[model samples]
Target: MRMKRYPFSNKALKAMIAATVAFTPIAAFGGGFHADQVEAAEQNLNFTDLESLVAYLQTVRKHLTDEDIQVLNEAQEKADRISAEDYVDRILKAPVSEEGRALFVATIDFITEVNLLEAKKEDIEAFAKEQSPNVEAVFESEGTSITMDQYLTYVANVEQKFLDIIQLTEIEDLSEEKHAIALTRALLSAKDPSENAVITKTILRNINQEEAPGAIKELVQKIDPNLSAAKVVVKALKKANEKPEEPTPPGNGGGGTPGPTPGDTTPTDDGVEVTPVVEANGNEVIGTIPDALIDEIVAVVTPEKDEVVINLPKVEVGQTVSLLIPAELIDKLKAKAPDADITVQGDGVSYEIEVEDVDTAALAKKLGVPVSELSLKVSVNPVPSARALEVTKAVQAKGAKVLSQIVDFSVEAVGGDKSVILRNVGNEYVKRGFGLNANVNTNRATGVRVNDDNTFSAVPTRFVTEDDKQKAVVKSLRSSVYTVIEGNVTFPDVDKGNNWAENYIESLASKYIISGKTNGKYGPDEYMTRAQFAVLLTRALGLPGADYDGRFKDVKGDEWFNVEGALMAAVKNGVVAGKKNGTFAPNDRITRAEATAMIGRALNLSFVDFDKEKFNKNKKITDFKDAKKVGASTREDVLRAYQAGIVAGTTKGNFEPTAFTKRDQMARILAEFLIKADLMSELK
Candidate 1:
């Protein structure tokens, strides 16, 4: 367990993902709204309630930091000293009057201030379902003159504003477009219109345009009683979009408005496709938000003074400590902290503090701050860990927040990127909806490399497995290549074979110019030794001296088995001989590491290692997309090979790093390489 130095959890970060957990109670952890939306809401002066709230929030924003008091003092002093009306004009947008603009600025400043009040939400105000009269009065600038119709229009506009936000405050609805309006109206309007037409349309049809035809067809068949020939499908569509509370004719019902005709080509701007409501009658909701009226949000002017600073009596001077050190002295400083019982946190220049007895003056002097600035109550606003800070920045950049309280710091450490960071949504109910369509589970992917528009592709596309031994895969590739060299390989048709890869290779033997043994067996499991592969390479290429090279330490007179064919095929042709170390280890299994080295040597490619330690070279070939490789004679050679794409992983995508090389696999890899290198066409 980590120590909780401050009163907050060590991992209580502002950027943790909001993933849903089992046994977790229902809650909305991932609210779409970002700090900016709240800021935007604060900036809108057209709406009264929003304006008032904005004023308060602005104040909060101003003082959000601990250094704010000093910063404000300096900025305000500068502002006071200048007192330029033109500068004030630049900051305010009130119509026609400078004083009005100043008042507007004041309102902004006030709202910004209110946002800082830790006591916010403590007032606990609610209007329940009934429409709040004040909401209209403020929007219209009339305490009692606005009509209900006018008030609703204002509600729509407010809803629009919230919808425009990347995210909004936590609300029960948001499942559909109409719900946006309902959600907005509900927030301000007390009346839940049972007949509200808007609610019906959004709830049933707004979000299902792509699948509407099928949904409509099903609805039509279920309510078959109402569809006896000649009715316009539009009428059916209208019926299907209806709300449940509204009465329908001789109903056998589920809620639906009317459906569309066969010739309909597109979805409505409202995001719904017209479909026939075939149920004896689909359900209908009766609700309409009349247009042409304006929405009004009222503001209650609260007169209050925010922060006020005053001249203070001179603080008794404190001792001073300076923090300037040369790099050469850092080691000496670092060496003293452990023995001195002092806590120094930052890197280099050892900045720390340890006081057995601190008088006020000594404390002031030690901190290098004036006594006047010190407070008996040292309130350090909550700060998340550095890992969480990265997450906060990422989430904030995307206009989102981390509302889930979780101890898993990895999500934040991954930087709140949806691909890499897992979210703890704090509630199982809400976790169901996340990522693009909320269909893909993000937890499985290692990470995502995102595009500028926030689109992402999974990194290292496949999962790593223990079976991913690079050596084994390399062996298999060699074996496959050997099989390709010897043709007439009769094998089960791959289209029906249990092991498709093996069967496919056998079928392609002739296509690769592979002439198999007279026995008709491809020796599918045969290990393709390096020399055997030379024969295959020689057959494919016309190279100088493609015959014999008695130059190898192991390829001696009595020992050369297929050396006649292999030596001519490999040595004369320069396919391969051995490594820089002089020992070919030819009989030894060929690992991806070795394969990479071989390919590097074959390709004469250069491989550099800037940070070899960070990359796990042992990583098996998992990504099939990698095909280019640099053939070299070193261990790094394998990495270059994997990176270049000359090699790939097995069925599970792991080039087993420590496994043996096999003949069939080698032949297969080379054959596959032929296709990749564009040297040979894909086997027909």
Candidate 2:
């Protein structure tokens, strides 16, 4: 029997396909399949399918033989012969070629699309009933029989299968159009709109378009009119439709007709003549920016005392501007503009105030300063876009604190961007997003800094808050904020009693083993270097004496007094080994696994006994989710330390063994090790 092939109508296909993930092809008779062929095909076709499906489709796009199709069909028939309970399993287990994978995805997608159609319940029931006879007859031919209820269940679960396929496929290889279409369809068909909306938005934001185009717009329109999806679609479509074009191309171009001549002047409503700023190309004046389109932004910083005053560079309202000021300037700004809109950001906190109707003269008099002196510091202010404001809000949501010595604030237009960086530091593999829209360009940076916007560094285009990505950003930001921490518990900048490890830190500090930086701040979240870690360990262990004989090339003269003695002691005790280059990189941050191993060595030196057998038997360490990722050599040490209650994993079930230990973390671990090793009492 020739299998039935139901092709969608041409009109429906055209409306549905912006990019397609629908093809089931066997090994092509000839031609090599290009890796990029699938994505390019997505630009013209409709949406849907998984990896085997993607690979199969890629092969089909390359070539296929009639014999390959026959073999694929026969394999499918054989797989279908299994019981309904065994259907999914058998299909997954069966060995098939690239064509077979495409067929699998296509079959699942077809059934899912049919089930999700918005027809009447009665029509759906009737359609299912009508299709049952044929479905069952085909199963019967394969010596397998399925009840009507089982068939309906299979139809209902087809959505899940499609989801599975999508999860398995290398979405990076799929075009933005294809991903957008698939996600949009999934959003529309989802039974729970609220839950599905999140997934759809996440996918859309990755491929986030400044404006929805053509089929995407239509797809968005198909969703419920009252949903935010519809509103977003309409807005995107409007943006696309309303995008403005430059008056004319710039430079010395000998192109078509030139715009208004260089000396040409137009009269304003007030009878004032204005000449457009145009670039000269021989006699032709090209690239005109009209006077009406020019906008301005000005910022004024005034201090009560006439010590230091600043008037920033003037910029257009939509242009991005960064303000660099001394940390002491914050109080002056507050006095000048109290009740101003303030947002605490990295490196500094910023306050914005409108410059509409403020009396500069009176304000100067009130502050006991002359108008001339006040004017030296203050300038006109520009308003930030709603999108920029939104970004500020998101940044603040993750715990933003002002920097110590300097403060910087920046604001720019929403769409006038150059590029962004999306660095994934999570343990699990993450699929790359569609990235920024076509308008933005991305360039990698050697180093990133806050408040520096001239070259793209830390700007994020797609932010997935409430996920590992957000936490990673927070962790990284916290680590980067401090290079030095010097203070006691009462120090204002120390952020006293903020974390659960406060007690541990305070205990260590009380013993004079831990001290803050010269700035009177304890940077708890700062990374702990090898030298720093060694000093802390020796101090905690109360190892005596200083012996320096140039054992390691990196450990130099008397200037290294702080860690030199501790380093020599640690080396003698077999706690640390220098790098392969015969250099002890004392400044290098210590990883979590390395720290644990060091602690285990110390415990052994101190004669602390814990059951190794019990540690190996404990499911908490042995059955960790990411246990396999731990280095084979250090895995047993980590498990033993964890079980002995000297250390713990980062999250509930997974030990991020390779992650670097922070200063605060080192203190906490030291405290825990002391308690577990019965040394806490001796310290007191």
Candidate 3:
């Protein structure tokens, strides 16, 4: 009986030849695979049965060199792993044309090259030197001179292009023209709209002159007709289509004339003056605000005080406009609003403001209240200038005391609805011993966004000192009225002097890092389970775990800790590991030594040399009498935790390595670790 034959396509054969030639040297030295063995295997490519191919490859192994034998063995192993049907199906489904293969290969090659570059980033100079030849070849193919800086720029462009390609590939049945339009949309959404405009024009120039405008309009309408990016793309494409092409310069061949070089002040065919595009940090740079539009906006600075009022023209909801303020004016603005995101581009300072009406429903949902309960109010004076006494009176009327000078400023969210950081948001209440006083706790000072109903949502706040002035920093997801307020937060069982961990418990609870047991009672003396400790540690580090898949056999997917992703997060971060039996022992009581080991791992502490003789001579573990009882696997970790001031011995002078850790003790140890490791600032 005759067997069916599966022949390789021309493109597949070419790929095989390229791979063989490229890896021949490595195969020779590594005793892997040689060219002759691959050539022999190629002759037998007609074998439809995977087993028959494996048998044939094995038969040729005895007649080849060591490298050739290794190659034959690898081929045989691959053939053995696949079924005959799958092998035939793969060959049938393979790309037939060189163009199809090239597209697939280019996508894969770009991804591989990017990964390699990222892996070699620590030794980038050496990596770049090795890759220079390949980079040079790319530029040489385009008839361009290459420099090290230009090479870097080319790499960045390739990476960005790869990312753009990946995004476009996600849409089904994406056309070539649609891909070009999508690229324009992405560029227009960048921080510098002017730079994006030039790129959008370039994209438009590449498309068919007859089809470009219609394709852009159709794609933009499908995406968002009102989007600022879409608007910019429409305007840019129109201008690009209207511009007449420049005459071809005299050259060897009639290839179209090249575009103007950087810093070239050549006028276009339409007699409009061309602004030279500056090259900055390997990017084509353009001014954030155009020169012609500067006179449309007005900025008035008052002489009596450091205040600058900006009067902006009417901009649409999603539209972004840049203003170029003078240095002295920027200085005054910064003095009044220190948290404003000010970008200094060349001789001008530009800042973007996105205007949008407040979403009352979303705000109410975020505040955990009904939409009907939201009191939506819009101030007639957008930028209010009020006296201190008047501000104090207003805050008192709202039933909240103000701790800092009334900071009035507008916040602009970068990258569309992203969180904005407000630096130096409030006065230095910490420096004034606010928390040390019996009546108040300065640690409770936090920034809050004032709602129209007089209620406020607490912002994630932190404290830092700049030029000897203590400042409160806050981060908010929306633009609104914000101020600093201090108030006491206490739990029934975790009051002052109740336990050694009272302060730690209250502090962490106030920050929402940990919570009390049922009925608001904190079980300070209760033994903490391994799962409980894992949850607390994950929360303290602010590690994201919502998407984590549980891996432990004993840890069920439906368990509270696993559902919350705490246990999975702990395992993923290498802070905790399962037992040798593959069980997480989630419900088991966690020992003191075990807790310290997890803390040490979280801090990324290095292992100490654990020589018994050296330890006896150096008396490193003598601080705790029962240090010898520490498990060998956990000894180095415990020692690391002790040295880092994250743990301490009991008052009885014993380490108690096998003893179970209690809630209060864990709280104290975790708090100390956070403080010592300077990780407290990461808490929200």
Candidate 4:
């Protein structure tokens, strides 16, 4: 008989089966067979689920002799003689009742069909390996002490109980209750069952009604009294009847007298007269307000303003004064000020604001250090018309001391649409290798944001040297507390002492501009292929490539470069061109000249003269000794790229245009291009 084809691919079907087997529990074997005796009799084939069984089979298949195969075949024939219903009845030690027989039979048929599918040995092995994590999760949830046989017994008992409940229920169509039960099952089986239990209970309490029907509720209580599916149905009904809250009247606070309006003048207890200034952009400015009167002004100011900017006298050095803006007022300051100037000013003293306390546990986890080893400080600066913020840490660490100082910089209205540049903030100890012992690679310092959930997320950061000082520059879009931490990415093969491109590689890797090989090595000296270079260039430019239509005959959709959309994006952006044969030799090694041409085109560097010959004749672009060796097609591109600081010649003043570009050389070129084009923020 021909096998029935599944809707999904063979690999997908195998994966689905693996996942189900990994999570499913088998029925316990009966007939006076002890667990140990059954295990020995089955030759360790008494697995809890199919995933473990398949894994064991694959492992032993490689070493199985002809005699062993014959023994296994004989055993399989005996197992096959038993019908699915009989096997279930024997393993479960209970016969399926009339009410649940149909469902049980349907499940058995599905399993039989899966067994009939032609799965190769390698396919089963791959599926086992892929689902190993899920299998481990199931065992972990069930507890390590519980053996496969014990788990099977427990599962069988649960199944029998569920079947009994089904036999007792008269309602044939309980679709709504079924959905609620499904949700409850998922929550109970989640990684954190206790936490999910609270969520389920809260949901039920808010939606449960005294007048709602109790039949489904009683059924659900029989399954799990702590969680009821009928509550969800009540929730749906209540939600459908819920009415929207009425909007508050303008200028009125719950039918009370209207509060202080914009432009209102209020006097503090200290007799410091404060006036609220409202701008055309809806920004409220309370100028010349003394620091002592901030609280009074905050209390009287209306919360409807876009943002409240309080101008005060210079804050004393080392004195931290928290802003007293009300929670409602802060909520109103949600509009992003992308174009607003944000700078650290006032000569060692600046306006300070209170932000959420740092999560030391999360920070320690991210930095891979003990909570006791970390210390954090938050600094707030509110400046007018400033586009950049520079918060300097002048404290120097002593010899051999772990410099785990985390400086948090906070700004308002810096939206994701625009990035704020922070300079000279976290590079004090980078040059001295202060964090080497603490697993902090100072050479690879990165920026991170403090998430609302008290977690840290990496932000794009780059390091640059200016005036003999190494500075860590970070760009962020959100107005929140941001800090610089030692980057966790490093390659065993790339060393800073000998490799000229180590900084470039580290910076790019930290920002996800490049990745290492499978062996955790950054093949810096290895030659780069055309497709590889194109992919790196696309990442450097941050281009979002469009859907490809097989523009290059030789580049297939399945190829990594095509799937990555590098070649397609390069072609779309006019940064690369195919050969005369109409094929992009993506796998071919890229020459320095070819790479230079691509970089020049990406930067949009062009001469006024359209003709290359005329442009070359008009300008002496380079003084390289081997300038003539450069191909005529790329000579102008090479010269233009050099002029734009995107590429450099050899030490001997020879442009090795025909040399195959190494991975290190490619990194340097891309880094230079990003810095020169101002695509990335660099400290001056």
Candidate 5:
């Protein structure tokens, strides 16, 4: 009789699994004498519920051996002797004895070993025919049996269930998918061609068609080098069957496979021979520097012949050096490097030459060789001076705002009475084309000036008046990248006209935090509000998010960056609290005492181990007689803020605790707070 086939659908398959799970047939066995009865019962065993039958099959799925599958197939090919009801009863009533469990486990191992699901249709048919009787006989001995249709249906059910599990799992979640795919691939490779060829084709096709990651593709290639899974599937489905295309060697194209002429040689423009950019190091292409390029030292310390030739030790890129070229060669070298740094070294011993930026193309043309073969190292920056050392020490003593030191600078010719070349004297280099407002005083004279376009033509003559000097200072200090006056910061607006908080404003800007408006105007007298203060505190501490849920009702519509978020974060982090109104009146101006209290909280939160007691206990508040007038609510924080040197009283002995903090005053406090709190690193 022809065997019946039961195809699976998603819905039907789910129903089958659900039905089968209810009937976990625990199997049991004992010696029986009626041999004919056993064979007869095996032939007629029935399945009452299709789902229960499927579930029973699943219980022993992992234990189903190649031999067991073969038995079921062969038995089905023969005949259906058992009734559906009888089959279900026998399976459900079967006690889960040790022997049955062991048999199930063994069958599962066999299926895994042979990759049973991947077996080709013809191979499966052949195995069923060959082992059908044996499969029937074994079940008969256990007093239960299944037809070939039932057995095939059960196998299909089990395979589909596993595949569904893999499919439903998160695609990116590879922990389980990786292991399952790997183990199946191993089994596929180990099984006979007839047993796994079909399944391999299916798996490979799925992997190729899905939006799989590279890792899955790699696994498929590992499974079969000759049989292309996707191509085989396509060929199999074609009406006019054609031969499946040959599989490319593993790692072809973008993978491990090498192209023609592996390790082919190529030459660079410099006459240095090297291999192609693609090298087979684990099948990855990596860039390589020629062996001759590393640690190359080019020496041009001494002149050669009348050409000013350089010796090739090694080529250092981007290094500018002071070259002691002869006066006759100076014009010739300058012509070659018209746009380079060939400034005179102090006292004119050597001309500072930028070797890296120098026209190497021009140099190469002159040398009659490729630029690669041209080797030279140039001094890039000047050596630090005593003035640089002094400036560094002074700034660091004030605060740790300096990021880097002055490495190079240019100066105009120094000769006239007011034409003094102020060499390197600040955090940044004093280069030609650089603008800096400087207040100069050397005991003999005192004046403020600007270095314009590498030249300072300001000359204080006998005819100059006091008002003229003041006007000259203001005009010269309109807008500069930097300014320094008598070891203090000098802002464009903080001149003789308005220098109340000049020291504090300069200190903050130097730390690289506070800044002037786009117009270069530092509004020193503007009132600072609570919302502004919160944002500032948050920035100084590098808090997590720039914005958060609206924790304060009154702080709505404030769309500025970190306006609401900063206030929320501060409150959440216990750095600040709302007033009794339960609203954060962020727009309201904050008083000196209130600002001091918030600053104190920020310090404590940031420092972690900040000594609140010690800060308030030794509070010598600059001999402020009005300190007692400070509100009790903010008295301790007031004293702590004063001692921290961030907040100072008016001219003498008067703590103006109730006074509103100006923008420039706030800047001073923040600068000092950052320094003392050790939070300058967070600015980066």
Candidate 6:
């Protein structure tokens, strides 16, 4: 059962599935019946021949169900019995000679071939050989030889034929599988599980009456364990009286057990929690569904705290939304989710949810965690004269190639160089960022930016270049995650250069290292905390296979102190083979000297070529003296990783060995470790 590989290939995994599937039977009837029998019954429903029937049935599998399946079995049994009975009854009634039975089989063969035909025939007799009857014998005996048409037509319509086949079987007839299948289909088509239990019982009754076939009864109970002899009788009565109808209950309908009497409750606008009592087995537990399936469903819907929520209108049938949430929320969200009609993401947090109504936003907000964060942007028709200079500078500073244009506006007041001031103000607005806005008014200098309830903000910067905001709407679509992540390293089409790595490293503050200052922006040059250094070192050494479960008292899921422990684990794993303090100084701005020492430690070098005083401690890592020392001292380790093509300098092929490593630098360093170790290589 165990494979030698750590991660089995797809082909090997499929072989495993196949090997296991041979022994996994369909346990619909408490393992009383084989899967092939049910499958055969399912197969017989659409057969012209065995091959075509199997092929076609597979395609229509989504449409096939327990009721149709049951009916097929019933009809098949009835057909076989009637066929035998008609054959015997006609022979007994007529007292035909031996030659007549052979002739009758030939006629039946002719009819079967004609039915398999691709062409229409006006007279079946044209294709069939008419057997000239025993004229003299016919006069003496009261027997008749019928045509193929008459035989086929009569066989299809007769009732008594159904009884004969039931008598000929040795093994118990598994009409139960068909019954289970058909009724399950009915519930499925109705798109409700509320009626699933009832339908299951009704199927049991139609097949078994006395002592009730244990197999059928077991299947019925498997679906609705509360179903018993009394309940089965009541359901049989209901089935006999009522025509089959699709289940369409309002509160979690179709598949669950049908509610008492008029089986629907109306939805309300008011916020009253509607609790449902789903019964499984004979017990009335607080909630419904088996433990295994419930856990599986919950595992799919747990949600996390930090993900974007898009404001949307309500939902309607056939509408779907791709809502993204954090990985942590999968369980809690699934617990409150509707059981019927909605199809959500398999990942649970970022799932594509199908809503019956467009007003689903209201429901989602109520059922899911509340919105936690918001981002804002402002737009204006044109940059005011005072803001133009700042706008220009921002435009220049943008690391991408951009088409540029400017407008000069005369400002009458404020400074001697009024126009210049207006331009500078516009530049400042660009430094902030903007979009085109139709409602921006040039006449007014002051406008409200933030709304009172913290509901909305106006992005008030603009360009006269974008005279119409609609014109700014681009036709291009954003690329997928695979593409965007690729751009984090690749030189962009705009020739922004490999400088993207710097921006990527800079952006890592949010996901890679630590929290920012109160100003809501990372102080990129500020000294990293000791805890931050541990994290950086961990990243530099390449995050190794972590057995650390965040189980320690100081390393609970949200604890900030986990960083040091995580690094310590990395150290133990030979990922970071260094240590400074028995306790790490979690809040110090590390100097260039310290960074080199740490990198050296990670390389597991017994000695550095020069003394500690060889390179200046205060200089940035970008300094050449430090770079030379690092490039020369740990040459072998650096060469090992570098020649393996895992290590490289930031710019101009120079390893800025003396520069103070920033947050981004830490990530690059760690990425090299990962690449060299042949671990988490995708990070490269």
Q: Which residue pairs does candidate 3 place in steric collision?
A: 435-442
Query: Which lDDT tens digits does candidate 1 get at residues 1-684?
Result: 632111000000000000000001001111111101111121122333433433343343442344544433443333233322332222212222332233223322222222222214332122111233432322232112433343333332332333222122222222222222222222222221323322221121112212322322232222221221102111222233334787656765777766522212122232112111111211211111111110100011011211111111111011111111111122222232211111111101111121111133433454455543322211001111222234333533432222211111111111111121112111110001001101111111112222233321111111112232100000010100000011133444222353435533653453333445556555556666655555455433322223334556665534453433544544532346576666555566556555445554444411111222433465543343333332233545555455556575668655555565665566566655444433343444
TM-score between model 4 and native: 0.35
Q: Per-residue lDDT of 234-277 in model 4, one digit per residue for the tens? A: 23223333369998768554656554354333433422233432
Q: Candidate 4 regions off by >4 Å?
A: 1-486, 496-500, 605-619, 679-684
Best by lDDT: 3
User: In angstroms, how far off is 206's CA in candidate 1?
Assistant: 68
* lDDT, model 4: 0.40
Clashes of 6: 82
| TM-score ranking of the models | 3, 4, 5, 2, 6, 1
Scored by TM-score, the top model is 3
- Position 594, candidate 1: lDDT: 55
Q: Each model's TM-score, in the order given?
A: 0.24, 0.27, 0.35, 0.35, 0.29, 0.25
Each candidate: RMSD: 31.4, 22.5, 29.7, 24.3, 30.9, 29.5
C-alpha displacement of 243 in model 5, angstroms? 56
Steric clash count of candidate 2: 17
Clashes of each: 140, 17, 1, 3, 37, 82
List candidate 5 stretches off by more than 4 Å. Answer: 1-491, 495-500, 510-512, 561-564, 606-616, 620-629, 680-684
**lDDT at 136 for candidate 3?**
42
How would you encode candidate 6's per-residue C-alpha lDDT over 102-132 as one tens digit per residue?
Answer: 3433333332222122113333334233432
Show where candidate 3 strays beyond 4 Å.
1-442, 445-462, 467-469, 472-488, 546-548, 605-619, 681-684
